[model samples]
Target chain A: MRNRTLTTITVVLAAGALALSACSSSKKNTNGGGLGGGSSANNGGTNQTYKIGFVGALSGPNAQLGINERNGATLAIDQANASGKYKFKIALNAQDSEGDPAKAPAAATALISDPTVVAVIGPAFSGESKAVNPSFCQASPPMPTVTASASNAELQNQGNKCWHRIIPNDNVEGSQGADWLARTGAKKVYVLSDLSAYGAGVAGTMAKELKAKGVSVVSSGVDGTTTKNYNPIAGTIAASGTDALFYGGYDAQSALLAKALVAAGYKGRTVTGNGGKSSVFTTGAGKAGNGWYFTCGCQDATIAPTAKEFTAAYTAKFNTPPSTYSPEAFDAANLLMDAISKASASGTATRTSVLDALNKEDFTGITTQIKFQANGEVQSSSLIVNLFQEKSGAIKGLGNIKELN
Target chain B: MSQSENWVQQLPQNIIIGLEQGSVYSLIALGYTLVYGVLQLINFAHSEVFMAGGFGSYLVVNGIVGHRHMTGVMVPLTVLCGVLSGALTGAAIAWLLEKVAYKTLRRSGAPKLAFLISAIGASLFLSNLAGKLFNRLPNNAFPTYFDINHQLFKIGNAKVTLIEVIIVGSAVVMMIFLDRLVNRTKLGRGIRAVAEDAPTAALMGIDIDKTISRTFVIGGALAGAAGFMFGTAFGVSNLMGFTPGVKAFAAAVLGGIGNIRGAMIGGLILGQAEVLIAALPFVGAQWNDVISFVVLVLILLVRPTGILGERLGRAA
Candidate 1:
């Protein structure tokens, strides 16, 4: 009886293990196939389709920004498809990276392996883009990637020919932000960065620019994740009597700092880089976010004119207005399709041919005129600087603030 | 100026910020220590329980309150709901883990190593489960309810807000209450008895299984409270639990795995250390995690058995 019972237990355990493995494997296959399947659909000659993959955080804490990018990309693709200028249908394979550096490579790898993918769109945040950029280096006819939101200088400095981005790097954004602070007649600026590559790089760059403009960088540093209360730091900033504060980080910490700074009686204006430009900051900080300024690559209102029809189509499809990155994603899709059409016109749609076409192409996007320099940084005329208002809980885009010549 | 004045003047503001932030870490650490006191297994998924509490409160506040502006009893009530949800989830997770993983192994006389492995698996499974269910996005935000921007008080040159007061005060109160319960209550005796010797306690008519379950529930409740506090303090996200979980675990180990008081002490020390490290003039803020792990390693090196040393018969 004991021997039979042992066998039964063993069999039950094995079955359970098998079931768990099967379920997990199936989920992985679905995501993997979802990314690669777009490429396969494009392979059929009569119904030639081009797939572009956009990887970013679509549903996490950073969902607002990622969703916007996704929406922008989708709108652009829809317009391109409607124009009937391309022989193939433009399909986007979007996967969420959850804003994690570790998961970005896997997502990028999956997208790059797809044979029919002409170009890649994003990994959203700079940290994720930097994490995944190394993988594109080894791909045959290297994957041409256009980061929709990545701004860290390290991404451009990666020395990889395949990496390209439409957004201004942190150097430009940081310089502009510092200049804004200086314009406010702030003699001393207190700076805080998140300590991530994106945060530190931007903060460091801003400090350099602030010093160059003869403004004192009174104090600068990072806040640890374990540290929750920001009042003490805000108190210190107020006590230092710095004229303004510049935070180079994402919305979560920025919101907390904004609240704390206001509570601590810092009357000066506050500025943050692109990562901090989100509705979350205004919402989380509430009325304290009033008069806060932020700089990003594109303003939603500027894109609104070119994107009105796209927005209407997106609302018709997704039943809501596209989030911030959607227009960029839409533009990316169009850029890819434009390149693909040019490449396919020569009989075969080779990756090299597609890349060559992408290199020479100049497409006007909602955000900027998308043209890449040798290093793949978009050669744009200006970056958007916006003032976030607590009442509207939205960024009032102040158009493109031209770069200082 | 005097040398002392000069030193004070030169001390970086960022370091002060780091220390203030450490206060939250201390609160989360208390929960980990309390649970480990009786049930020696590290409550690996406690962080997720805290995350659930935050999200739960966000849902309630966003869905029910409907008003953009929050005030009066609404903030406290929302926090309470958040705490309750977190506690309930933690309790459920602890009970399920015992029933599915630990209980069977204990009954079969499996080695302790097996239980450790199972616990790790459970932690990974829970984290991934949450990731899959929620779209693996790390940037979700807790719905803003209370506006914490108003200054509540100012000390000399420093200003403090109601939010800071709430976070620091509540954490302290909870810690004291937990200490009193463990030291003075009959339930606490039962917990001590079980921790001392489960087989002997059972022989003395102390329901071992029930005590363990109760211990888990209490720990879960504490973790839930921590989660609610975290959401209110720092905001919420799916992966928000990860760093806190690791830190809380570090605090537990720092305090001594089965020593309740040790966890409390360890947590405060770790929190303060992390903040101070981040605030250091040269180090700045980005070294927060780097500082935390460094302190953890130092603690382990200096006192491998932790501040309190492991309790006998508590290796569940």
Candidate 2:
């Protein structure tokens, strides 16, 4: 009886594990996909309505970036439909990849199988981009993906040809950030990351470049699963007595670290990769965020000339200013829509026609003129550095926002 | 300043940071352990109670501060309002969870698994409701009214900050108060009697339901208070309670599920381990959580009743 009961327990446990794994590996049913300024809706009707698939994190720690992308896409779609440019209505079919690579394959498969989905706007972060690449490239008459801000170079190294990101790769962010650090003349630097693929990628590259530039670097990783106390990392950074501290992580932890660092009385200038450039970082860190500089390739209303109207429209629509990469997200959507437009102008725009159109396009976007190279990289992608400061006791750009050439 | 200069020198500061964090964990853990003590059922919805407290705090803070900095009187007043609202909200939500979610299961004499499933459903319902009401993204923009991070004192390389002092201070006061209430008060005796022998306590005219409800309120209030302290340090979000909830559960199990004092020690130990393990050069912070569960497993293997829990006959 005992042996039989043991077997039964094992079977039950195995089934439970399998069920959990199956559930965790998929998560694509989330169609409302935008948690920030994203209108919650179901599938666009099966008739007369063309669908654009948005595959990124719609609900997680990384949801802010994805929502920014979704809002941009939604904004673009709303504009095109309103303009009566296309005879048919375009609807967004946004899926949550949870910003995780494991779930990306299922989302990719779901997007590829949808007959109405002519093109996709994103798999926002670099790791998710890499996860979806092979599946997207391997699809028959491969679908094109235009990403606003997935900066990892490995996504391009896969030679998927189906992936085109307007933003510069991690190499650009790392080298550009290293240049700024070097320019500040900080010989000894302390670096830290949340240890995510994106976080580690940017931090590792920055550290390597900083070392090559004859700077001494002390680096560490913090637990990013959830926002725990960041005081230890802040303490280590302060105790190190580094001239400056550079972080390669998201805004939430950056805010906490900045708060702790300020409390610890660390006088060094705090800088971060693209992860820290968002308004979320500034708001999250509050007063302690003052005088901290961060670098990003993502276009925001505050920085881009092309984004002024979009920002105004976005603020009017969402009642809040768009975050770091919304403009790039808008540009990316425009690029994809442009391809769809090019394809639709011909008889029928299948996934193949969209893919073909994506390769040969020289589309000009507000953030930058979108042009793709052979390896799906932008021709000359760049990064901008901005500092957070106190203006009228509110944490914002204090004086003039300086652009690092 | 390089990595070569002994990392061990910073251990004291790391420990202090860990204790502050652990204090927050202990606050949340008290709720889970307290509910378990009386009902003998895990209340998964308790995390939602904690999250509710955060939203309560966010609303109060939003009303009081509204994106502007305040000096002197406004700071303490704002914190007081936020914490009180948060505590009250947490208490109300805990009472509701008992009434709406678990009370039926208890009355029906249903199996424990049924209660667990219902608790989980309630947890998801509350989380999604919060997500829908508030934006799903991290609502971290609220200004901290009390901006006290100045150095309080120093021990070796570790400097104590005012924020840490407040966090540790509030947590210890609450824990001590609850411990005294559980051990000394008339209601405390009733709760202990119910925990010790529910049927017997009921026969003795001790109101089991009332005692259980009171226990939940106390736990919920402490958790809500902790939420305000935690939100002040880390920002609040709809999903904020989850990780701390899980860690606090681990802390409870490590401390012996029904033992209040054990939960406190467990939270502190877990917090210290999370930091110290991460402090080790190559293993890093990622391994800290893994070490936490491992420690729990080792403790269970060595002493199934936990450090403070007694023999089977003396379980209470």
Candidate 3:
């Protein structure tokens, strides 16, 4: 009786495992094939189709930012297709890196392998951007890449020719934030970084700028990606008795730190970089999230005059308002589409042609003037860093950081 | 004040924070130690069981509270509901895990390595399954039923929050209950017999399979409760179990792998060491993980087995 029962149970378990494995394998095949296989052979046909790849954290902690960017790009593509203006149909081939550098290479490889993919919108977070930029640069004919949200200053030093970011680098945002702090009468500032490429870069710049402005700076780093409890760090900050605390990290960690600081009874003003500008930060930190200042290269699309239509369309399509870099991503997609159109105006729009067009083209976007300098940075003349504050549970823009005084 | 003076002032609060964090680690560590006691197999899927408990409690709590602003007695009642639901869910998952991942292999008489690999596979399957079922957002927190950050009391400069008190109190109560259960109950004797000599215990008419299954259930219940506390303090996510789970596993090993009481001591020591060592101005917080492993290595070198020595049969 026992033997029969055991055999039946074993068979059932084995069948279940097999079924699950089959389901997962089939899902992968469908995702890859369904998205990338729609490439039309361009033999002088106006109905030809091309894919624009977006590689970012579609899941995980940074998913909100990536999802926002993907939605923005998707909206642009849908609008362009529906407008019947372009000769070719534009499709988005989005790959989820889950914000892990280890997972980025595979995601980037998947995009680069798809022949129809002319350009990529993002590798979203700075770590994933650093991980996948080499592949994007080293691709045959070199794939053009533009990031809407990655703000690491070190990314510019990577010397990748095809790399471009619409947003200002960490150097700009960090300095502006420091200047704002100085103007606000913060004498003793505590600067904490997550030790990630993005966090460290911004924190280092902010600390340097603060020191230059004669502000006493106490600096430290924690690997916020792995550390869950911030109370010990909060204790150190509270004990330091600083007037302002500046954190350079993503939303989740920053939110936790805010909660910890509040729990520790630290009354100091709290500030963070663009990485903490999402609704996740406010929601995660709860009431502690209120009255915190955020410095970002991206602006509020809902309030931008040029982005009114874009904002409305995004809200109507996604059933949620455009957030964070959604407008920047919209501009990036539109910029790429413009380049594709410009490149194809005279001849076929190959990867090389698209790159040439993107480099040479000067266009106006909803966020800023879309023009890349020799080193793939947007022209400094057009780049601006804005300050935002969380008040009464909503993140409100406080205008340009330079204009904050 | 000077930096040294600042450090001295911060020491009391840092210790309080460390103890609060350590208590949760101890609860999770008990799961690892208990499973190791009977099976001599490291169940990697236990982490997923922890994650499952968090989600399970989240569903029950979210269903009960919804968007309503909870206050007064509702807070404690809600927390109790969450803990019970979490424990029940964790026990169910762990039971299923043993049946699916361990039982089939055990019946086939597979090697120990196969069991380890299967546990890992099961862990991946369970976490990803959770991600697929729930939204994959990392910051999915419980509804604010009450002020989790409300100050319950204070130790020096450190304010002991309500959540911290609940976590530490529950963990202590559970650990004491677990210790007594293992030491005094008939099931305890059966478990000890199986751990000591499975074949001999089977010859003596104690059903080894039932004892092992029950042992897993007990461990799972503790982990599930820890999961609820952890989720309340931090947020719940599919990947939430990885860090705490690894830390708890380390605590289990540090306490002498199979020793239940040792796991408890090791967890407290590890937590205190991590927080206190990282609190030093020169060392900084980034070196916290390194300090934890270095302490582990140093302790292991001295004791060879662990702080308290290994084997549940000999110790518990």
Candidate 4:
């Protein structure tokens, strides 16, 4: 009787274990299939929901920036969905890229594989976007992508019509940055790059332009991605005795450099490319970031009348003011939706049709007029340069938004 | 003005800079070796300890010091607080790990694979935890406490900053102190004994648990110091430790796991190799990671036990 009872207990325990294993395997499959299904199926009916994929650095060091961009895209989608303009609802499939170039390809591949995905919104950092661009271009029927944050010139060099950016490339932004330094009558400028492709590329271009304009480019240095202490480099800037300091990098290192420069008693003007124009920079560097300037492709919140509505809606929904890239994201989503509408009207909204629609797209966005050049460069005005104020610890619009002729 | 002459003149300066940078790596590598020596385990979370230490220093400098700019008292205080916090955190984690993961397994005589899997899970958990806690924004700067721009010395054409001198000098001093503690102390002996043969050491009256806990504290303290220095020197973020932790682990392995002096030598060599690789033309800067990993793989292939063999014990 005791032996019989033991055998029954053993059978029940084994059955439970098998059930748990089966459940775990199913969960993994669901996660993988969900991403695939979410992107592939457009709800396939008259009342179908159209999906747009967004890939960005949502969970790493740049999570805040990524979330802000995602928020802007969400706002646009929500508004469109609520407007009842189409036969389908808009759904977003957001994935985190972690701001790494290596991770961007995987994220891009995941988004591109989804057949129902009409367009991709972003992979914020220029380096990541550039890395993923080729993979996107090679996709069957070629995915039409609109980056909210990427501003590198090289991205447009692909010569593919599938890519349309809402943000202006760094060429305009870099030229604007150079012009700002030159307009201030700064004779000598010290330049430092983060040593990444994006940073080195922008800093090199800025330096070249500055040098061509007869401005003395003194003391160029390269910093590693892991660089935290900017004192040694900051001291070089201080000692170089340049009128202004220009850094081409993201906010983390840029903020530290700003603080280090101030600590080293550097009283000169400071400037950075779009990558440095994050709220984290202001928060991290605090008073040190004050009076520092950054040039970005997007207009400041104050400059965009439409942004006031965006700000109100964003703040009400997310409980925070949108970051610098928020407007660009809004523009990208709206621009894509415009393309989608055009494509659907023409015929079945296939990838090739969407790509054609994107190329021919010309709509006035919240930030600026969204139109793509033959090279996939956004035909738009130059970026606005904002100055970070020490007292407010916030970036203030500096009345320097330049239009590219 | 000749190319060869310029190259000759630059060599000594480059070496000095390389050595100074290598010293920082060595300090972090020591933590990796200490943990591996006693437990026969790699604490992937060590880098997070380094990151946490940096954040700890940032908090101390920003909150307590109340200075946005570097001041004289800020550096030492930050480092002190950083090390304490790191050691405390490490000790707590080591204890918890033993209680929750390793202890039951040790009793059951579980396989080594289980421990490794558990360590990886713990690492991912801690890293994600930090990401959630820190608002996931890359922190650009911690408050500077001192002017790092002052030149301490010049080697021919190369100029060395005061910060470099401090970093190298402090790292060496700490290493020497650690060497003495591990070689000449009773706790050190027990740690060495356990690494040699855990069951035998247990039979010989060594308290394996206590030794392991102490080993973790020591490693954590070293990592903490590295974190403080790294944050003050470079910057800190949620994912800051991932790459460096991998590199330091590589350094530990290259120096021969469970070997102290090997770790020191391996770290300095790796740091210099990375710097030199970055300087090579055509290779460009982006190839630094590629070069480091290739070198690591090659080194492991040639010398499976690393350059120093595991029998060197805990003496550096």
Best by lDDT: 3
Tell me how far the alpha carbon of residue B138 in candidate 2 is from the true structure, in angstroms, after superposition. Answer: 2.8
Q: What are the per-residue Cα lDDT tens digits for candidate 1 across B278-315?
A: 54456654566677678888978998888777763365
Q: Which regions in candidate 1 have their CA more than 4 angstroms from the true location?
A: A1-45, A223-233, A302-316, A380-391, A403-405, B1-27, B56-89, B128-160, B293-304, B308-316
Task: Tell me the tens digit of each residue's lDDT in model 3 across B97-159.
Answer: 898888877877776877786777777778777776786666677888878888987766667
Q: Rank the candidates by TM-score, best first.
A: 3, 2, 1, 4
Question: Model 1 — TM-score against the truth?
Answer: 0.84
Question: Which candidate ranks first by TM-score, i.e. highest?
Answer: 3
Write one digit per residue (lDDT tens) for candidate 2, span A1-405.
544543343345345545543443244343343331243233355325567888887766667777777877778878876776765667788888878898888888888999888888888887778778778888887888888878775777887878888887777778767877787799889888788778888888889999999998888877676755677667767778789888888876787788878877788878876666666666677778877776776554665666788988888877878876788878877787778778878676788898888899998888777778998887873334334443322435322223442
lDDT, candidate 2, B107-176, per-residue tens: 6666677678677767776776676567566646457555568678899867888778888988998899
Candidate 3 residue pairs in backbone clash: none
Evaluate every candidate with DockQ and list the scores: 0.34, 0.22, 0.47, 0.20
Ranking by lDDT: 3, 2, 4, 1
TM-score of each model, paired residue for residue: 0.84, 0.86, 0.94, 0.76
Model 4 misplaced regions, further than 4 Å: A1-48, A85-88, A216-224, A239-241, A264-267, A346-348, A380-392, A401-405, B1-26, B36-45, B52-82, B97-122, B140-180, B192-204, B225-236, B246-316
Residue A308 shift from truth in candidate 4, angstroms: 3.3
Candidate 4: tens digits of C-alpha lDDT, residues B1-316: 4424433444555465567667766777888788778767666667776666666656655675564554567566665665556445544554565554455555555556665655555555555555555545656465556655466666665667666776687788778888888889998788888887788999999988778777876776677667766766666676677777877888888888878888888888887776555444344344556666777789999998888978634432
Assess candidate 4 and give its TM-score to the true structure. Answer: 0.76
lDDT of 2: 0.76
lDDT of 1 at B21: 53
